[model samples]
Structures are given as structure tokens and as C-alpha cells.
Target: MDLRQLRYFVAVAETRHFGRAAERLHMAQSPLSQAIRQLESQVGATLFERTTRRVDLTPAGTSLLEDARRILAGVEDARRRVEQVAAGTEGVVTVGATDLAAYRLLPRLA
Candidate 1:
């Protein structure tokens, strides 16, 4: 439901261990568990199967993971594009010249 939750989910999915995921996220394990619980509630589906030994993704969780990846990628792309535009190097540039001009002018320009 939130970016934090998505990030938390990704960490859990990657490590398949709550304690490890929490350490990687630099947060307490309880909050990470709570966030995952809240996300499951928000989506009306369990995201992970938990046991004393390990954690695994549920079917719903696997599906959501794909969507989460796409969403994160889009957000990253938007940020990059915005940064590039702000730096004045984001748009298309067109160069035109005749073959004869290329033989003469291109060398000079170079």
C-alpha cells in the first residue's frame, strides 16, 4: 500500500528471512512484520507463508511481487528522467547535413 511496505516486502522476498530482511532494511523485526501484516490486510491476501524455520511466498505474494517490481522500476525511471530534464540533457537532439557537407564540415566540427 505504501512505498515503505513495498520495500519491506521486497526485502523479505529476497532474503526469505524476517530477521535478515529487517537487518538489511535497518529496522526492527517487529515493525517489518507489522508492515507485512498490514499489506496483507490491505490487499486481502496473505503474502508469505511463515514458519519457525523459513518464509516463503504465497501465490498472491508472487503475483504482487511482479507488480511491485514494475512499480518500483517506473518510479526509478521517472526520477531519472526528471533529473535529466532538470539538468537540460533529457530531450531529443537532431543533427542534419548533406553528404557533401559531411565530407567537409564534419571534419572541421570534429
Candidate 2:
């Protein structure tokens, strides 16, 4: 549903335990569980099968995991692009040369 929810879902799905995921996420277990519930509700599917002893991804969760990964990767790439542009390094480079320098020195610089 949200980035935080997707992060929590991915962590839980990978770890297969709410407590472990919560620990890895540095959050309390209850909120992590709540976020997964919210995510499943928003997606209109159960994302995991839970029992006393184990947790497993539902088929929908397995499929959605790849989508979530792509979504996150895109978001991060966009952020990085913005940061690079802000830092004046978004594939823009400056080269200085003089007419005489080009004849004798530019080839060596290259």
C-alpha cells in the first residue's frame, strides 16, 4: 500500500517470521504485523500463510514480490537521478581545451 508497507512485506516474506522481520526492520512486532495486514487489505489478497510455527508466502505474495521489487528499484533510481542532478553530475561533464593545447595535449588527456 505504501513504501513502508512494501518494505515490511518484503522483509517478512524473506524472513518468514514476524518477530525476525520486526527485528530486522528495527520496529516493534505489532506495527509490522499491522502494516502487513494493511498491505494485504489494500492489495485485495492474502500475502502470507501463518501458523504457530511457520509463515509462508501465498501465491499472490510470491507474484507480487517481484512487482514490489521493481517498484522499489524504480523509486530508488529516481531518487538517485534527482540527487545526481542536484549535485550537478547527471551525466554532464566539463572539458577545457585551448586551440594550441588541442594540437599537442588533448590527445594525451583523452
Superposed model 2: Cα runs more than 4 Å off: 91-110
lDDT of 2 by residue, 1-110 (tens): 78888889989988999999999999999999988998889999999999999999999999988989889899999999999999888877878888999899988888
Which residue runs of candidate 1 sit more than 4 Å off their true CA positions? 92-110
Q: Spell out the clash pairs found in candidate 2.
A: none
Model 1 lDDT tens row, 21-109? 99999999999999999999999999999999999999999999999988888989999999998898988767899999899998898
Return the TM-score for candidate 1, rounded to 2 decimals: 0.81
Instruction: Find the 10 residues in a row with the least total lDDT in model 2.
Output: 88-97
How well does each candidate superpose onto the true structure, as a TM-score?
A: 0.81, 0.81
